[model samples]
Target: MLSAGSLATLFENTIGPAFDDAHEYGYRGEFHGSNAVMRMVLDEQKQPDVIVSADAELLRTRLPEDIAPWDVVFGSNALVIAYGPDTAVGERLEGEEPWFEVLSEADAEIARSDPDLDPLGYRALQLFDLAEQYYDRDGLAPALTENLVIDPQEAHILARVEAQERAAAIVYKNMAVDHGLPYVELPEKLDFSNPEHADYYAQATYTTEDGTTVEGAPVLYNATVPSTAPNPEAGRAFLKFLLSNPEMLTENGLVVTDAFPRPHGPVPEEIVP
Candidate 1:
């Protein structure tokens, strides 16, 4: 199993138990974050039986073409402003006020991952851009970006929020809830969770290189099996189990996506189902 930061707690506390419950029944799997999973797959170093990711795009971009084509959207998540009560900025933004104002303040500190490497980082940038439009603030994106110090991995951003090292951090809704952190909710218009707004959000793009741009939307988590997987049969079986077990996922604080017939690339036919 592979995932992003917030899901770590859920996987350990919830999903791990479910797998254990089925362990005697012959269900066994290991979970890791998307970054580590991707590196392993890309390097052809240690090909696990299964591959799941917090972002589907990683599979699209990193995996070899000969790998399985089909990718599934088994779950979904929304981003939110996360902070603790002890945080100086969190304390100040406790009421019905826009978080951008507090975040833009000169003394405020913010944290995020590098967009170039992590989808969370890119989504953070998109959220700021959306907030700027919603609030009519001209420099909101730059202001938020300027305040941020990038962590090497998306998971570390939560640590910064929990440690109160930063005033605020952009994180998934489930993460904030799981950590019991105080958060200011962004309007659904800006919260990328609503698929109806996907087209609108998707229209917004962030330029990575000088002239290259990528469209944006709510960050999506995806999964696939690699061609090099030593136990392709086991990978497919685990994928099937993950898709069929919505209750297991909800116990982990995940919201399953209704989208079906998940996209895939050309791979072994045996594992396609």
Candidate 2:
């Protein structure tokens, strides 16, 4: 399986083992930025049994129909500012001050993923853009931009925060939980997690290094088995297990929509509800 980095713990600790026990075979997983994983498939010719991505639209747009005929929207997440409680900035972040205000004044750099490689990276930028507008704070986005440390991997950023090597990082809610970090949750209007705020989120946009513009939308987790998968049968069984048993997702801090596990395109009927 090739999956988003934010889901590393979930796949490694929970789902992967569960599938192994149920199917009587072990499964291996590689986790990275959704875009990076897609690149591995396209550019490096790496074929995994399954590909699960953080962005539903990315799978729909980047992968050709023959590569991934369909995808299932399974889960959702919100952006958060996870901080190291030992850092100077972390001390102030524990106060009643607004998170953006504290971040703008902090001397330590705020860590985030690279926009070119990760959806969370661009989503963090979009969150700041929406926050400035929502708070009516002029130049707030640029103010916070003064201290960004963009890395290619969010998991690495979180690791830095955990080690107190970095003061804070912008990551998914589930990531913060998995890393045992205290985080400041952004409001729905700025977090890009609420479907009702889709229009508001759309106002914040980012252009990647490749010049492909990404507009903010509700964060969605999607999964699919590529046509070139090495183990198509195993991939289909895993998807069925995932969709039928979504409690695993909620336990890992992802929110499942009421009408979720929604299949699109030519997904297999057994996995479709």
Candidate 3:
């Protein structure tokens, strides 16, 4: 199985352990960050029994309808400014001054993933745009990108921040807490965790090299099994296990959304329920 970091926690802390104890069947899960899994699914290289992603936009834009059908909105997360307590920016973020000002400093470094590859990457851009409005910084995007490096995934970005390689990085709230990293809290209005703010957040979008555009919203994580999957039966079974145990994910700092929302187009029936 191939899955995203959020789902990786779900499987590790809940699904994996539960499934292990059940022992009626056993499957090895290979966890990759959202971007990497999208790349793998798009390339059709490794047909894992399943694929879970941090955003459905990846599947909508990259994977063809024939490749997979239903995607479940298994959980939700929010973006937060994460940094180590010892870092310069982290220290300054404690104050009332806007975060962009601190990040604009000469020595500050901001880290993020590649937008074309990761949803968090695009979401990071959205957060910057929101911060631009929230802080009234005209050059926030360019300034934020000044010291940015593309980490492989959201978790990796937090790792860099914790290591103090970068002063701070925008990442999923669950990830920073999962790693026990100290972080400044963004207002709930700024945090992309509520559906009501969808329109405000939707104003932020990223256009990929292929000219595909992804608009931002509350951070929702999705999962799907491709039609080309080598083991559709196993994939369906695994998904069934995941959806049935939503509470298992809470311990890992994730919030499972309602049942899989229907996709824009037709989806595989087996995985839908």
- TM-score, candidate 1, is 0.84
Q: For each candidate in turn, give its C-alpha RMSD to the true structure in angstroms.
A: 3.3, 1.2, 2.7
Ranking by lDDT: 2, 3, 1
Listed in order, each prediction's TM-score against the native is 0.84, 0.97, 0.86
lDDT of 3 by residue, 1-273 (tens): 787754555576668878767646677787766667777877776788778787776766677777765576767877777787786677788764566677766386677777876777878777878778876779887787777777865545677776778778777777777778866667655778887888888888888665778787777777777887887777777877776676776666676655344344555565455
Per-residue CA lDDT of candidate 2, range 18-84, in tens?
Answer: 9888985568988889888888888756898889999888888888998988999999999989999
Highest-TM-score candidate: 2
Clashes of 2: 0
Candidate 1 per-residue lDDT over residues 1-273, each given as its tens digit: 545555677666766566657644334344444555666667776667667676776666666567746676677777788876776787778864568777877386777766665566677888888878877889887887788777766655677778777777887777777777877777876777776787878766776532335566655666777677777676676666566677766665567655642556543445334
Better of 2 and 3 by TM-score: 2
Error of 1 at 69 (Å): 1.1
Say what the RMSD of model 2 is: 1.2
When 2 and 3 are scored with lDDT, the better candidate is 2
Error of 3 at 147 (Å): 2.6
Q: 119, model 3: CA deviation in Å?
A: 0.8
